[model samples]
Every structure is written in structure tokens, then in C-alpha cells.
Target: MGWPYLGETLQLYSQDPNIFFSAKQKRYGEIFKTHILGYPCVMLTSPEATRFVLVSHAQLFKPSYPKSKEKMIGPHALFFHQGNYHSQLRKLVQSSLNLNSLHKLIPDMEAIAISALDSWAGREVINTFHEMKKLSFDVGILSVFGLLDESHRENLKENYCIVDKGYNSFPTNIPGTTYHRALLARKRLKQIMSEIIYEREEKKIMEKDLLGYFLNFKDEKGRVLSKDQISDNIIGVLFAAQDTTASVLTWILKYLHNDQKLLEAVTAEQKAIYEANEGGRRPLTWAQTRNMPLTYRVILESLRMASVISFTFREAVVDVEYNGYLIPKGWKVMPLFRNIHHNPEFFSDPLDFDPSRFEVAPKPNTFMPFGNGAHACPGNELAKLEILVLIHHLVTKFRWEVVGSQSGIEYGPFPVPQHGLPARFWKESNHHYRH
Candidate 1:
């Protein structure tokens, strides 16, 4: 088949991506053609194609999709910047997420996790997703900008929701539309970021938080970055770090709840670590978090199975050739990670929850939870720490069980619990551990 130009396909794809992507893979193999909102798209479904598009030839594939950029993240975000500007901003921002910094932040991360868990005591049924989202947001605020005010926290959360909902709606600045609301949210966010930057500059606060680092940062020529550049970079990091971690943790809880054996193993490992620590005097250290290899694998497995940001869309800068097929210039090319992640060729029993798949023998380029290459998520290290620490805390403190049906989780852009991840947790009676 050359290409399928069915209008209904776009509707179906937008409505339920899991079924649509699966049907395309079954019918069209590794590479397929489809249309979205009247634009042609080549959907790449194999690891080879994904590698080529995202890693090998990423320069030719830019992420500044007209709709996604103009509607979703706003034009001011670093996500839409290209060439030297993007490179410089990425470098400056990426420095904050470096391994050493992340290691230093582990105690803070664990303290936040423990605080969140402490608040949930005596509750029978709770939505883990909501709690994780709040906790993740708070951590991001504190670690990124040193935000501690309660009112500011609420405003940030509300603005994030507005912006997230703005992405899929029609692009317009007209009031009452989703896009318009998102624009307003963007404006509000930019104002808050500006105020923060100005205050940091005026007070000369030399703290080690990301905001302080950016404020004092200088370019190669000794020229300091502008306030707008700093604001955009901060917003970009905030957007990427907050929700992605929350989604991963939510899915991890779901998987652990469904699989008793895996949950028990993870819990046992956590207990052993706690027992060795003697007193709960020190928070969960970065060294200890990294030592939890099994916990890391579980988070990776959950991320692989739950394809967050399911497909990445890139417009062809110029005509490109792949397997003798011409991807014409300006055509939308979407690398479908869901298809690649679920493909039996790369993973055995692709649909099953098995962290051992990664433990026994990990596959490079085949498993991309954060993505790949130059554009690969810079906050990957921080995300890993956040997920691992959250799981470590949750598993050690309480035992969780699915409230009702224990069927495998459903897939959204983010793997969302169909029933709000309703789980029952009780304080662990073993009490054999200190931390």
C-alpha cells in the first residue's frame, strides 16, 4: 500500500491512540502513512527508523511543530528554539541536572517523599496519581526555584493544568478557548518567572538552586543571559521535570500493585537497605538510591510499558530518503515509541511486566522512556532519582493493593490508571527496619 488518506483515521487516532497505532502497525508494518488535521504524516514504528530519526539525523528533524509549539508550550519555550540558541540554552540548563547536583539533592527529594507519605497515613483509599503529581510539583518548585510559599505553589499548579489542556485545542488567542486559556497561563507563568528572576538579581541570592545558578550564569563571551532566556529555560525545565516524573511514579505504583511478586521483591530490597542504615537520622542518600538497581529497573520497565509522550512529531526540513521511500520536505514524521516498545522483535512477551528484561540484558536504542540523542531528555538523571526515591519511600512505609480490578494499566499519552489508581495502603507491621 502506498498511503492511506482516510479522514476517519485522524479522528480515531486522536480519540484512542493505542488502538489506532496498533491497527496501523498490523496493517502497514514498520513504516506507515497517515493524515492528521489534513497534513500527511509518516509514522515510523521500528527501532531502526526511530534511531535514524531521533539520533542519527536529528539535526534535520526539528521538534518545533507548528501546532505543538504555537499551541502547547508557547513560542517562548526553549523546546521550540533551534540551532545555536537551543544548544546554548540546553547546555546552561543541562548543567543544573548534572549527576553531582542530583546526588546532592537526594536528601531533599527523600524528605519531600517522606513528608507526602506521612500526610497520607490512616487513609484507606487514595489516588496515587494526584498525590504524586502534587509531591513532584512541590519538589520541582523547591529544587528548581526555591519556591516555598503556599499561595505561589497553588498558582503554579493551576497554571500548569491550564497550559496542559491548552495543547490539543484549536490555536487562537480568543478568550474562552483552550488555546486562549493556555496563552493566559503562559503569560501568568512568565510573570511569575520574571518576578523570581528580578528578586534573585536584586537580592543577589547566591544559593545553589537552578534559578540562582541561571541568574549568575554567563556565556562564553562573559555576557550574561537575558531575563527572557532564563525564564524560558526555567519554564522548559519545570514543564518537563514535573509531569513526566509524576506520570512515571503513578504507573510504577499501578504495576507494583498488580504484580504481587515484583512488589514483594522490591519491598524486601528496600527493607534490607533501611535495616542497614540503623537510625532514620539521615535522609535517603543519593548513593543508596543508585544502589537500588532493581528499583531503577522497575521504573525503567514501567516507563517502557507506559509510553509517555507516546509519539514525537518532527517536520522534515528537507526531503529525506529512508528505505527508498521519500519523506517529502515539510511532511510530518512521527516516531511511534509505543509500537517499538511493544514490538515482539525487540522484547519478549512485550506486553508483560518484567523488569528482568532490562536486568538480564538491556537493549540500547530499543528502550527509550526519556527519548534519545541530542534532544534526549536532559533531566533523565533527576527523573530517575525522583522515581527511585519515591518508590523506595512508598514501598518501605506501606503495602499497597489494587482496590478492585487488577488488570494491567491502560495507555494514555501518559499511562494513566483507568480507575484513578485507587489503592489501599497500611503501615508495614514488620517494623524490622529503621529508616
Candidate 2:
């Protein structure tokens, strides 16, 4: 804690968050207390502590966020709740994103990737993370609605972008403010979702997508979900999918671009698949996507390196004790995923960009790129599939170069390369892969 009331809020926000958290862990050990954003928080860095808060004793903690964020993303979003509601919604979301269902989206996902890459080829330098966000948004829509009509898709994207821009802004609700505009846009999104829901209901059309799962669900009490509930969960999933995936994808590109040898190896792995698919004439199979061990390791390393979701907020539901320490009720508990990922005790040469280290599985609870326990990202598989499909097309068909001297990270609430790794891409020549 720092000055009165303000506490350490300024210190936490004034410097790089990683530096702030890492310094605290260095000075005070794995579990330390601090005050920020007007709340006393216990930041946990050790794997055991993280597991206690997120898994083993999760019942004693509840997910917490600022009131403004809850309102913007929808109060009924699944992550914002626990107990029966969270469990039931998680089941539906998990079922929708299950392997069997995601496998079906491969062809469509590939097309989205190709289209995105094609749009950027030979163009002026573009922000890779920003472009990846659009790609991720399209994939999110595909997973949620399963081929929604073009007009409705465009409408949702437009309004969602406005809401996203305002999400992390100052929470002032005055007219003309980003947060205020986000509120208005969120209303428009609800209206658009209402229309889509009405159409689905009127047609009694139920496909095996997230929306389908939500629409068809009935709890043990025979209670059906309301329109607001359906819309909120759908928006929640989209919000979850967009930035995190894009940021990781952006980091993957930067990492690959910076290491030519690694880039060549990943390119070779993808080229074998490219040739197996008859030089892009055939679609990528689920098996092909699964077998890219090298590429998969690169992805794992990127996720660990970036740790986009550095930490998560949970509040003690009741006074809790762990290993002789007392956590008073109402105190916020944060599991520092980034600190654990970068910890030397857990990962040797933690600062190096080494994908080979993943050859052996990580120790229990040490590698939680998506998080841990009941609240781990349900769409993680889908997110990975989207990344694989895009990388398959990108490496096999396009060559890109980072366009600036960018060696720093920026946190737009998620760590992404400075200026989103401004870069240019060109279609790879057919003969480029020939010996």
C-alpha cells in the first residue's frame, strides 16, 4: 500500500505492470498484500497459491471485476458468476466448442484465414494485431452463430468494435466519452442480437453451434434461458475470444519473424502439410492440424512468452487461510500467471524464446496460458484451431517482415507488440519451397 486512499494505484499503473508485480514478488515473496484501485489485494505468484485461489479452494473465491466492465460485457456473462449458473453455462459453452464441433469449422476457418492474409498481401504496412483481431472476430462469429447472414454479422462487428474501444477507457459515463459511446453501442448490439434470436426462434432452426446450445438448453427445473441471457453469453464468448487470440497470434508472428531458423523450421512443417493438401487445392484435415508438433510448440512458447492474460481477479467469498496465512473476506486475490510463466524455478532460461523446451510436458499447474481449473477458457481449443489454420495459410502462402524497429510490448489491457508489430506481407512464390 502507498499513500492514503490512493494506495499504490499510481505506482502500479505508472510503470510496466510486469515490472511492478515482479518487483513485489522479489521483495515480499510469492504471496504479498497491496492496495490498488481502492481495494486490498493479495497477489499470488507461486503455483500452489494460484492453484489454491483458482482450483483447490476456488469455492472460497469468486471472480471479480470493475462494475463498469461488467455492465459493458453484460452482467449475466458466465465468467461474472459462479455456482449453478456458471456451471450450466460453462457446460453449454464447452459442448458447443467441443472437438467434434470445432473440427467441422476447419474449412470455413481456413477460408477466413486465407481471405485475411490475401487482403494484406502486397499492401502497405499494416498493424498485424489489429488485422488478427478482425480474423479472430470472424472466427468467433462462426463459432457462435454458425454462418450468420452477412448483414447481421457486419452489424454486430461494427457495434462490438465501438464497445471494445471503450471497454478499458476511463469509466466516466459523460456524453461524448468513450465509455458512454460504448454503452450506446452495447445497446445496439443487444438489439441486433435480439433480431437474430427472433429469427432463430421463429424458424425453430437449431444448429450445433454455441447459439444452438444456448437456445436449446433447459435446466433441471425446466427453466429456459431468456433472450437477454442468450445474448449476454454470446457477447461474452466473443469478447473472450477476440483480443487474447489476436494478441497471441501477433506475438507468434513477431517471434517467428525474429528467429529465421525457427521460422524456416515452422515453414517446413507447414509446407509438408501444404504439399499433402495438393499445393492448397485441398482443404486442411483435422489430422494434419493435430500433427504439427513443431508449430504447436511454437504456439505454446508464444503463449507462455506473452502471457496476455497476465493475471486474473478473484475476491475471497469468506475469510480463508492457506499455509498459515489469513485472507480476510472481501479482499481481492490475484493469481499472477505471468510471474509463474516467467519464473526461473518453473522454466529454465525463462527469458529466451525457446520452443524446444516444450518437448517435455510442463510440471503441474506451471503452464497455464489459458488459466486453470473450472474457469479456464472453454474456447481454448477453438482459439488454437483458429491460430493453426491461420498459421498454415500464412507460412505456406505468404512471407512477411516486421516493418519497424519494434522491440517493446504495449498493454492495451493485453500485451501486444509495440504498434501491433507493423508489418508487410507478400505471397510466397510457388518455387520458394523447392530444393
C-alpha local distance difference test of each model:
0.76, 0.93
In order of appearance, the predictions have TM-scores of: 0.91, 0.98
Best lDDT among the predictions, by candidate number: 2
After TM-score superposition, what is the CA distance of residue 95 in candidate 1 from its true location, in Å? 0.8
Error of 2 at 255 (Å): 0.2
Query: Can you write out model 1's per-residue Cα lDDT over 167-238, one digit (the tens) per residue?
Result: 656787788988888888878977877776677668777877787777777777898877766766766777
Off by over 4 Å in 1: 1-16, 66-72, 170-172, 406-412, 433-435
Per-residue lDDT of candidate 2, residues 325-351 (tens digit)? 899999999999999999999899898
